[model samples]
Target: MGGNQTQTQFILLGITDSPRVQMPLFVLFLLIYIVTLVGNVGIITLVRVSPSLHTPMYFFLTHFAFVDICYSTVVSPRMLADLLSEDKTISFADCMMQSQSFTHFAVVECHLLAMMAYDRHVAICHPLLYVTIISSRVCWQLVASSYLFAFLSAIICTWCTFGGSFCGPNRIDHFFCDVVPVLRLMCSDTHSSEMVIFAFVTINVVGTSIIILLSYISIIRTMLRMCSAQKRAKAFHTCASHLTAVALLYGSAFFMYLQPPSSHRSLDKVASILYAVLNPMLNPFIYSLRNKEVKGALVKCRRRFFNHWQQRSVVSSRT
Candidate 1:
């Protein structure tokens, strides 16, 4: 199809269209979005202000929190809007932008998790080399590469999706614009497009998953050889949090994207909500509540903030 002949707008049916469900759904999602913002922002602030969190692990965590915030923001606002709106429509350009941004940050997070796993592997398996291996420059490079490659991958996936013609029914069943849901709306054959999506997803999902698996294998092997039970317990405790996050994120993502687009529309929508909305909101708690270091940092940060406020109050009273 020619450029001028392509689709201009699309109707998003969203999770549902029932008048009875709108307000309840709106309220629920609005609260979730608020929590997502506060949680992610809190993690970023904690990482920035706490000197104890200046290590490589927290360095990657800061970026992960950033990605979570960006990813949730991409989907949540529009989703919240659609829940309350009668029409629930989005422009082609806007839909494409959402897909691209969502995919970019999501992929960045996938590889970032793998990188974090590798960081743990080095820390436990080779503590002597951890500092030299995961230096400040290398941390920057890992984060930079994640964003760079994820952007390129996002472009490819977006192109493959939008390149097809959308002459069929313009109504999307899901809450937001996604490659598979959008592909289902296309009048053109989606064989090539679906194949491209599959290949990219495999690389992004399975490829990173393999890295994480291998890293953990090594970490486990090294931990087993440790002389002290305390060392092993501490190491496993650190790994547990990242593993939980990876399971929640990748489990929902794989369920949503791995299968054919035509399968389980409602189920897929719910799973999408899990990863896009709930996961990000829960991540800060997962990392902070489970990890002693983060908890300590939060306590320290809180004290400093409270003391600063107290000093400011006293100065204002004197003035």
Candidate 2:
């Protein structure tokens, strides 16, 4: 590392420098963060309480919700705070920490989406073997592997990114400490770092995307051969939410990271917000609204809550 690399802090140029927009953006993102927490927590609760949803599909879904919650938390709070503050500075260690968590969740999400697709394939194509194949042990293994791989990728990518000398501009062009934005600040030669980032991103993003695409292709084939229109509709309906979630996440993520860091700086910053903030908030609604089981569970839980409240109210009145 050099003098610049050893520098303690960097300024983050947020989405907009306009004073008028900061407060509005803060309020908006705060609301989004709250909703994100409520929705994801609701989904996890529903999955836990509803015995009907105690299957492999919802099992993966519960963890997916958890990941979304974590992903959003990592980026949103800091962004909100920065939006309110004029300094908008982040420590070098904090910068690397943000990058590490961001990369970890992003990579984990890619693999998890692919795994969900595979779970659907097994359930749809091999109905009888679904239970046998995607068992409790297998599900844990899949999740564990997703985390393990993501952790490893995070370690390598973060090391490569922060290992370089950031002896140049201390002002980052984008909002958060994303790899591309921070890389632009480094004075050291980053050809090797860029290549390493590209390779890891290719595997985590492009590779997982290919697997998801292939799984969906097989799923389509299996659906087409089915004689019953009702069954076909049911199948499509079941996978619709997952597909939407995949599109939102993958679309934004690829747009943010897959291109030259210098090109589309503004657009990339916006895309980063979409991928990191909005996507996580939207995921729970996407899954829960479209999912009948989740809806039913929510209704049941609501009824129980009201019933218990009424009982308490009556007792209080009597006392």
Candidate 3:
């Protein structure tokens, strides 16, 4: 219970300790991380460069893409390294840092999705007032609030988790220093921490989810009243990408964190991989494939990039 008995160095058991699967797992996660970076970064850049995407929806999307990149980077690279290396030890500071960063991104993303939903809600439900209501200044304020609140939330969570003493077995059961598994290692009482985490998670997850649900419900009702089928189709098309992103995020996140710490098992690592790794890698594809505007922007960007490369090649040949 005292500082003298506290252990600062913790060993992460990681996804597995199998020698045979190490290289394979390492290669697989490395690829996933690479794609996550490229995909999320591509979306962010595409939105920035494409003039057509200068709306409130794409504005929120750019921020969401950024968060996905950070969230994936927080765990995937470290998890990849641990998969290959025999030493999976992480210091107290590093583990807390990772958890805090991960939690911050996760919280930011949750509210961003809600704000995006509200953007869509205004766009569809109040078509005439959409521009005035969700103006550029308003969008910036929404994004700023999401990040600021999430930053504070992350500090509180990290404190709640690390405030307890870690004088017992220092081995973590997961690939990364997850809160539930890490809390299990604490020798001191974890009830308050777990309760605080539960409350934090409930407010963020459920509150944001409610916002999304209500926004969609309003959008749906507006869609139903549309006299023209084309208008209805267009509205659905607008929100589809965000809806897919929300589904993936909430489904995996709920599975990962909605339970008591005692209920956590090996399966939690799999859930972590789903949201933290796979979701980031999948979002770019989800948006680019489903949204015609994003697809058109991608095509335009590709053509410009290729044309520049071709001109440079011809210049080099002439020289």
TM-score of every prediction relative to native: 0.96, 0.96, 0.95
User: What do the candidate models score in CA lDDT, each in turn?
Assistant: 0.90, 0.89, 0.91
lDDT of 1 by residue, 1-319 (tens): 2253267888888888788998898999899889888998999998998999999999999999999999999999998888777878898988889999999999999999999999999999889999999999999999999999999999999988887777768888788888888888888788888989999999999999999999999998998899999999999999989999999999998998898877856788889989988999999999999999999999998899899999999999999
Please give the distance, in angstroms, between residue 266's alpha carbon in candidate 3 and its true position after superposition. 1.7
Give the root-mean-square deviation of each candidate in angstroms.
1.7, 1.7, 1.9
Q: For residues 99-142, what per-residue lDDT tens digits would candidate 3 score against the true structure? A: 89999999999999999999999989998998899999999999
lDDT of 2 by residue, 33-132 (tens): 9999999998898899888899988988988899989989988889899999988999999988998998998899888999999999998999999989
The alpha-carbon deviation from the true structure for residue 254 of candidate 2, after best TM-score superposition, in angstroms, is: 1.3
Clashing pairs in 1: none
Q: List the residue pairs that clash in candidate 2.
A: none
Candidate 2 displacement at residue 20 in angstroms: 1.1
Pairs of residues clashing in candidate 3: none
Model 3 lDDT-worst window of ten: 1-10
| Cα error, candidate 2, residue 147 (Å) | 0.6
Candidate 1, residue 232: Cα displacement in angstroms equals 0.9
- At residue 3, candidate 2 shows an lDDT of 38
